[model samples]
Target chain A: MRTILSVLLGVIAVTTAPPALAALNVFACEPEWGALVTELGGDKVSVYVATTGRQDPHQIQARPSLIAQARKADLTVCTGAELEIGWMPMVERSAANARIQPGAPGAFEAASHVRLLEIPARLDRAEGDIHASGNPHIQTDPRNILTVAKPLSDKLAELDPANAAYYDNRHADFVHRWTQALQRWQAEAAPLKGVPVAVQHKSWVYFFDWTGLREIVALEPKPGIPPSSGYLAQVLEQVRREPVKMVIRAAYEDPRPSEFLSEQAKIPAVELPFTVGGTDGAGDLFSLYDDTLHRLLEALGHDSSKP
Target chain B: MNTTRFVIAACAAIGALSCPGTGFAASDQELKEIQQQIQALKSEYEEKIKSLEARLEAAEQAARAAEAKAAAAQTGVAAATPPPAPPPPAQPVAPAAAGAFNPAISAVLLGTFGQFSRNPDKARIPGFELGPDAGAGERGFSLNESEVDLAANIDQALYGSLVIALQPDNTVNVEEGYLQTTSLPWGFTVKAGRFFSGIGYLNEQHIHAWDFVDAPLPYRALLNTQYGDDGGQVRWLAPTDWFLEFGGEAFRGDAFPAANGPGHGKGAGSLFVHSGGDIGESSSWLAGLSYLQTRAGDRVTGADVFSGRDHIGIASLVYKWAPQGNPTQRNLILTGEFFHGLEEGTFDGNRFDQWRDGWYLQGVYQFMPRWRIGFRHDELDSDRLAGVFAGGTLDNLGHVPRRNTALLEFDTSEFARFRLQYTRDDADLTTDDEVLLTYNVTYGPHGAHRF
Candidate 1:
């Protein structure tokens, strides 16, 4: 019993010991939020991302590693609106960290900063997985990123007051560069305006809204449901009548459905990096949009090098 | 041109009339004088108009130069300085409706159809006493322990959950009801109220979350399927990159394995430690060690009664693998547990002391989306009893009981599943072959799946 007690005490001492560096620890639920925090916080914050860009944010399991990371976090950044309703709550409950609880200064939810799209008028299970708080895929729109950056930077400053000016300056730099990038993209993607397209999932509402693209048909019969062959056939029939320019899907989505639609319609199939680090070209927030626009332009037979 | 000619003739006539009744030659001379005078006057006025136009042009040029200078200064300022940083907009989105703070309530419905090669009513594991919750389903169609769960954040600092099980026999059981600290500092949490003890790895997991249709043989025999009691628990998680947790529980001892009539004073206690970490991006593992100590006073099961002190030790390991750390498509899970129990004191008025052991290994593989196949093997052995304790529940009967089970499962979505399971058992008095078809569905708020 004495040995057991001594060992436990040793573990407590080791675990509770403060680190040499006084950086604020941030736990980001998804890779996009992680990249955004890094862009704003720079060297003042240490970040742990719970899921990769290739993983579905909505379907992540509450892995133990996530809980361990959350236990040490000073702030938690996530896209709320129930996108992570399945697991983030469990991680927060198990972490036992007072600093990152909901309604605390250290908790930053990006969805609250901007108007969300596609709030369900009616709630029903038969409609497939739906978020009552609206579509949580707000990161698809670059304008929403700008909107979230201010509050997230404020949150960082709130948590680590010593680095407040640093975060503020970084946030200003990001906004300047992001605004210029948005302008350049608008000019480069002029030909894509009002282009008709097909999508495998409804995750690209914000993306379509940003680029002025028209959604012709979705391969999935409903949100979050994998497409059935019969449903795909109906979509193909619709595409035959409408003749969309291409079929688009996120980098993380399964390719089979969109590939089939592309084959049947004889249109180009475009895979876009939906978030930061989703593809090799999408190494940061800027390149994420750059690569996405590049793929969409390339599908339209425009020389990507010119843009 | 005509109008100009008419105006010149009219001016000449007017000049002629001014010299009334004069000669034609005299009129011509007078017109010449008048024209000369008009020419001189026109020249003076034209010169003045020219001077005036020059002054006006100078003023316009000066105004244009000043405007050009101002425009250049504005462009220069814009180039030299960046725009001022804009403040984050006030939340343009109205916060989502502050709906009533209602708990997330969900229900799981489980229905099963069972077929047995032998009479399930006569089922009994040799040398073991089964709890009321043990054994497989009786014959044909039956509703399993369907559950209704309610969970919510009580406040900023506390969380609470309740789960009630509805048995097919029209009995309602409180499977779990607990309040837990959410804002505790230093990776510590406190839980109070009736709860499943945090001993073995699988004990705390609800039945609806179980990977299989039923518990393993060791769990059934040693833990009475699952052990829950009125208790308070404290768990401390290590602040490390690796997942490490230590927890202990003190129970009121009115539940299974503890039997009845312990008269309070913490009739049972358990301590457990678990550690886990990821291996690269494709795999992760968790391992744990747990110990439980309790007293059983006049515990009775099917004419076999005992009064004794019980001690149980368990070691469990679970490893999961997915391609690129994504489990949506294909994945594999390998899990196993070892249990050892020691009992002392009197059994049916005989001095009884014995130690027994059991273990099981299970693996489930998801070959494709929504499809899975799994297999498990369970075995138990004991120290043989003799003399007065012979033929009793503790008697080994010179047999090492074992069982093997296989199952195939399909998930239509995250909220629904269908499974077909088959088992060959020798743990009971007579070897039995069991086959079961079950469907499980959950609706309302989705539940979290813990790894």
Candidate 2:
């Protein structure tokens, strides 16, 4: 009996070697945030991504499965610049989890930390369609990702205090690689030197600034307006006259206008990854830059190494 | 290859123009640079058109254009459906996922079951429900679903779902039809193909989309025979969250139960107005009124006797509130509506009064996270006229039918439901006792967000 008890005790100690730690259940509304969580948490947290990166976050339908994911999540992070206003309210209700209620610590609206652009002169629900507060595409700006990293690491620590230092160290390592990559991107974009571009929608502002590309014209006469034939013709006329290098847009935007212009005028259209994993070729965060910058350079025919 | 030839010609021209002092090494680099630029341009076109084109509607158009350059690029859908249904057994989706494009399409498809019988009153199939359960039903599946739902994001801003039902016969049916959109500027949206009208909350929703699995009887009466409007609609939301919608649709081309006209007259148009957004922390409401008119195009209604069309108006008040903090998570809904329809417009010159009124008070209480119980009381004051077969007067067979129902539902999940209902039907046409027991289940992927 003594021999058996001692052996069992040894096995129990071995199994219980790791300190009892509360499991982290995190919900990321978009795939980019999910990737970030994966990079930072490693094995310390469990993550659920509400929408795939390929999907436009603004137009998600509140499906029951998504709500279920929300229900079980301990922390819910959304790219909330009112980007998900159409469906997030419904997703939140469907999840039936009261812990991650908006304005609650368990819920993080990532856009809150970043500076917003295109602030409407007058804000009202009556103004057709409007983002009541901010534009939520901050993930495209890697700097914002770095800025939010501190908070994410801190939140993870609060949830699992035992691994606080480990989370901090990971954030530091991410900063190093992320900065290095950004420097290279900035240098490569130099030839893009104030090259004029036309954007189909307002999604590419941060990316345009980061790359030093100037947006000479926008297709939409008004925000969110579906391009009319007249508008397409007008844009073609403008491009034929101006010094525009390429027409840019996010993935999932309508391609009809781009094609019409590309055919009518010879300006090539460039579709960039709006979020990480927006394309299979652009899998993770770092590689996403490689894909985007490469596409831009290729559109301008600036990649001198290719044969 | 043509571009390659152009590059070679340009290189030769450059060599002839260059000064003898310029080195061959510099000229060689320039030629190589031109070649590289051409290749880069080619790659950019290829990547945008083939790989990421599916992401943008415009990119898709460009991709289709690019596809023409390659004989193998048959269609814009890609050379091969990139994400093939991952080898069946390990696939996450049901093999027979009804409709491929939209959950709304499948919602109508899976929820509907119909029959053509010599006797219009009774059903040839014993297993399915035909009439009086959902409203004006005649020997067909109610297609009115009470369910659990799931949906996954397809591309940015677009979602897909499947609805599963719970009820007698334990059948499944589609509740939503075709495309649905919530992202639009200036608070506007568009829906195309077969989908429920946005006249009232109940009419726009599936039984599974409701807090109570069974819809109130009046909603059924008003929307009977016309749950889904097959054309398209445009909705505009005002700054005050007030919504104005103008919609028109063609009727289902069902062979039997034909329309009142000869050539495809079965189409409808509607005008709706309402406001959205929460009223406060504890309550929210959607108040609206709508008018719907349908011309009997599908029917070959007896020409001289019943050749005309129909019109209906719905005024609804939907109030939602919670005694606790969460309104939808736990709440009470009080809804009331009055509907009126006119028939025999083409057959008879005279216009008679055809009015039906329905009202309900319902409440849902969540006892736990995944489980909840809902109860409702509904009564409809109906005046449905059944004309004489041979020939009839305005006074013949016109009776006021009053029905009251008590329904109990258990929500297994917000998107899935199991319901049991008993109704007491008293009508001028019948004096007999009527008792009914009904069960229904429904669900959609992320079905919680349709409202």
Q: Which candidate tops DockQ?
A: 1
**Tens-digit lDDT string for candidate 1 (B68-99):** 99778877774764333222353455445334
lDDT tens digits by residue: candidate 2, B180-209: 453344334566655667776577766435
Clashes of each: 0, 71
lDDT score for residue B39 of model 2: 72
> Which residue runs of candidate 2 sit more than 4 Å off their true CA positions?
A1-22, A124-128, A305-307, B1-219, B222-451
> Chain A of candidate 2 scores what in TM-score?
0.87
Each model's lDDT comes to 0.85, 0.57
Candidate 1: deviation at residue A238, Å?
2.2
The alpha-carbon lDDT assigned to residue B168 of candidate 1 equals 96
> By summed lDDT, which 10 consecutive residues of candidate 1 chain A come out lowest?
A13-22
**Whole-model alpha-carbon lDDT for candidate 2:** 0.57
Q: What is the interface RMSD of each candidate, in Å?
A: 3.9, 20.7
In Å, residue A169's CA in model 2 sits off its true spot by 1.6
The TM-scores, one per candidate, come to 0.86, 0.44
